[model samples]
Target: MPAPTLRLPSGDTWTRAEYEALPDDLPVRVGVVYGELVVKPRPRPIQRRVARRLATRLEDAAPVGWQVDADVDVLLDDDEVEPVELAPDVVVYSSDHDPYERPISADLVTLVVEVVSPFSRRVRPSLYAEAGIRHYWRVETDQTAPAFAIYSYELDDATGLYVATGVHHDRIAVTLPFELDIELKGVREPRRRRRAGR
Candidate 1:
């Protein structure tokens, strides 16, 4: 059987309104960059687990005026016709956001996090840096040992790019976005219990 097709608005470029009008039944995740449509498969189970758990860890350590959320739409640039809109796996933004706003303005965001996958390895670090997001983290799945590795980056204003900060396998300890020291296992990944007393 063929998959059901949804009619998309026709034009050379897409605006925020058209992106919002996409059918609710679409199976893939979607976004826009410079009025160009970008589509991604819905996150797999492991991907969801990592992102949700990581968001929890960051939320707990968030400052009084900061708010952490997973999979929230962030408007990178409000260029009217060519707005760059993206939804980072995890985001840290101001606490003063409006509840009714679907796409939070990029100016309110300080940190953006993305999980690595075969199709997602090189998603959009440059875009985030271009929007002035100071902190960014990319989570990569490890087949063994610690289970995941998080690569943190800080944006360099002069170069308009990201500078690698630290690569964390067992734990993430950083102070840029906020003071955070979270254990990889049990927090971001499940902690294995010993079979018996060591």
Candidate 2:
């Protein structure tokens, strides 16, 4: 798809009204980062696969009061001019959260997962850490293999930033987020079998 031509608001800080006024049928996914507009084309196949399957796996393993979701907008910052609404690839959140909120509030969120895309190789998961979400995971392809890897982080309360927890490849077994021990390979694309030794 061609890049959508846009005449976005010009200023240091864009308000919520300006964001809501954007065309609802845009060809790209849209969000705000500290009042600045952030847009990206939809996820490619590998990105989608990892996010969806992981969400399902997490939800299945979640404790009673927690749940997992994919592609839900989180109200990270609600500042009048610099309000932020980021939609992470996958999220683990509280089940008792109110349904009436327009976008899921940041406080209600526990963990957020992002699949590294070429367009967002350096995208800031720090935004999530700043919102006080306890855990953040980043998915990226391994340099030495065909499978993906998970780099996990825990919030550092003293610095208001995220600290590396563990890098998971074959499996994800974490204590917080409820003693998870799921195979990371399941989220990756299935390997194809060669027929007749071709």
Candidate 3:
């Protein structure tokens, strides 16, 4: 059987009211990605769990006038295609945010953490870098060794692209607005099975 289809109106810009009127039963999320109304799959359990852990870590480590949110929308433009929804597993925004809604810009964010899913590993980080995000961490939970591989991007003079400056394991600490440290070893992956009767 074929999956149900969603009838998306053809255009570049859409109002929040127009976005809301789409069918609620559709299995897609309507968010703007680079000025287009993009529909993407929702995150799975491992992804959700990673988000929770990162949020907790931030809340504990962050100082006053800083806040964190997960699975929230961020408006990159005035149109409906906001470029980033389902943003950061953990995102740090300035103190003045509306209680009911996500912020409009990726401004004043010190850290943006992404728990890289199998399919999204390559593309997601690049998107974040393009948004002028200062720092990003890519967590890989699907490795044989099961480790969180960290990557840091800094603006380069010649290339005009953010060059990866650091990569580390076991623990990671970022020094942006404040000092924050996370121990990745605390996140345990499921043990692999041995051959039946070895």
Using all chains and alpha carbons, the TM-scores for the candidates as numbered come to 0.86, 0.84, 0.72
User: Where in model 3 is the C-alpha error above 4 Å?
Assistant: 1-7, 10-17, 20-30, 79-86, 144-146, 155-160, 189-198
Top model by TM-score, which number?
A: 1
Residues 122-180 of candidate 3: C-alpha lDDT, one tens digit per residue = 55666666666666666666657445566666645465356776676767676754687
lDDT of 2 by residue, 7-47 (tens): 66766767877775666567789888879888776887888
**Model 1: ten consecutive residues of lowest lDDT:** 1-10
Error of 3 at 47 (Å): 2.2
- Model 2, which residues run further than 4 Å from truth? 1-12, 21-24, 99-101, 142-147, 191-198
What is the Å distance of residue 161 in model 1 from its true position? 0.9
Candidate 1 TM-score versus the reference: 0.86
Candidate 2 vs. true structure, TM-score: 0.84
- 56-158: candidate 1 lDDT, tens digit per residue: 9889999899988888889888887787888888989998897467788888899988987654567588888888989988888746635468899998888
Ranking of candidates on TM-score, top first: 1, 2, 3
State which candidate, 2 or 3, has the greater TM-score: 2
